[model samples]
Target: MNRDKVVLAYSGGLDTSVILKWLEIEHNLDVIAVCIDVGQEENFISVKNKALATGASKVYIIDVKEEFVSDYIFPTLKAGAVYEDKYLLGTSFARPLISKKLVEIAEKEGAVAIAHGATGKGNDQVRFEATIKALNPYLKIIAPWRQWNLKSREDCIDYAKKHNIPIPVTKEKIYSRDQNLWHISHEGGNLEDPWNEHDKDIYMMTVNPEDAPDKPTYIEIKFEKGIPVSIDGIKYSPANMIYKLNEIGGSNGIGIIDIVENRLVGMKSRGVYETPGGTILYEAHKTLEKLVLDRAVLSFKKMVSEKYAQLVYDGLWFTHLKNSLDKFVDNTQEVVSGTVKMKLYKGSCKSVATKSPNSLYNEAFVTFGEDDVYNQKDAEGFINLFTLPLTINAIMKKEKNEKEKQII
Candidate 1:
């Protein structure tokens, strides 16, 4: 008899490794481990070997770094999608892409169900399951944390020990972290306490801002229709561009954010994120937009950016509304082509200059210098027309007060 096959979103981490063994030993199911690489630094060969040694029937390691940057990261960057005005939606957007791959593999392998390592308490469970359901409603979903007897990470470690599964996490470094091309996120352990300041050792991607160099680093980033094309006059592919920026930005302590964000599951959780490259890209993109976009359009798009951020954070990427928002964002990006010069120092990326051929800024119109392009007399008629309703309201109030005085 053929044992039921299940596709597992395996990361070769402790949780997923334990789950892989449990699915085989306890449930008697054949497991196909799928690991999607989004630019995380890991030994794919070791990951595959460990999964096989731990009981996976097969392993599939897919490289999606380019797709992740161009499709997921760039769209969010162009939209300026920041969760709670701080988080860059790094982990949020990664989930949908991972789930998509899981579904695709499941279909190809004819797996009856899909399993994930996301804990029930976290937002990732909802994100993974939502994407899975949206893509394939008939497939069974197995979330090990919700159903398994292991109640905590400690228990998971014990199980790994009992089964002799080699894992990466240790008691001294128990922070659960997720990393990719866009950013690195730290959660769990000491981060659960709101008052506990994150230690410098917890950060993997960036140096501490105080430890950064005294001098600043400057770079020019060029964009075409909101997509970053080059940096410092050197053209790079999407993945390589982010890799280079991550190196430069991390050296200068460019992106570090500590946030207590409201989870989609209706709970507030705190996490520290390191998004060196993404931070630079977002600042450059917004600066260029300011150069090209009109005041009203830019203001309204800021509102749209917030909504778009929420949608991505809430795992609504596969929906019609999100698609429509993407179209709107793409339309707005048509004029968002330019180069922005920035200074990176002590965790800050400040735009010093920006230029775009589509810029709406007219020097003569706003300049105080003598020029025939704009006449000062034009302000008189404009102000009168603009304030006509206010003037009428004041006159009516004065007349009503006079009538009241007569009555008195």
Candidate 2:
């Protein structure tokens, strides 16, 4: 009898490798491992060999780095989105793109189902499943972690060794990691305990503050529609720009965040993330937005940004509400075109100067020692009207207190 094929989103990690073997041994399903290269610094050639060595009938390595940066990273950057006000949405950003490719490959190969290594506890599972539902609801999702009896990484390690599948992780060192162009995240292991301090060795994309050079580096970023277009006036591709920023920012320990964040799965998980490029871009973008956006619109976007972050962090990326919010964010970016100069040193990035074509700042109105902009006496009328309600409330309270004293 001919076996039905399943396309697995393979990472060559212990969990996915074990799942690949288990899917074959237990379900009799022909497995095709697909790895999308999104600048994760992973060696896909060796991963392909390992997948094939472990009984995958075929292995497909798709170079999705440019697509990942251009389609997903830029759009989120344009929207000025930061999940939970800290995470640059690094790990969250890769899931939908990877799942989208999985669906495409599955359809192309006429595969009956798609599978992933995302566990029940992490946000990636939700992100992957939501993408699958949105893109190809017909495909059956085989989530082994949720269904399998094996409950821990130990079980996975045992299974991988039993099946003779090669993987990178070991019992001695186990930190669940998610990597992409924008950032790299470290979780599990010592990170499983919220109180454990992340050692300096755990940082992948940034230097330790103690180890960073005792000097500052300067940077200038050009933006259009809130998307960074250049570095120091030198135009670069989206990926190139981020890569450059990573080098500069990482050298100075500019973007490292350790937080025990609330997962969409109803648990708090500790994560140490290195997001050098994303950190710099966020600062630069906000500085420019300050130049162009009005106070009210900027403040309103802050509220909407919280909602957007919640939706993205919660795996509601494919929902209508997210689409509506994206529309709102995109509209606000119309005038958010500018350039910002920043200084990065010793784990700090601060904006120093900002300019925009659509800047709302008027030197005449803002000057301290001004002559022709307006008369100083005009403020008396404006303040009197503005204080009317407060003044009335105070007078009424005084009269009421006086009447009470007389009655007493």
TM-score of each model, paired residue for residue: 0.99, 0.97
lDDT for 12 (candidate 2): 86
Model 2 agreement with the true structure over 293-370: per-residue lDDT tens digits: 888998998888777777777667778988898888889888888889999989999999998889999888888985
Q: What's the lDDT for all of these models? A: 0.94, 0.88
Clash list (residue pairs), candidate 1: none
Model 2: residues with Cα > 4 Å off, grouped in runs: none
Error of 1 at 332 (Å): 1.1
Residue range 230-272, candidate 1, lDDT tens digits:
9999999999999999999999988999999999888999999
- Find the 10 residues in a row with the least total lDDT in model 2: 308-317
Give stretches of model 1 more than 4 Å off: none
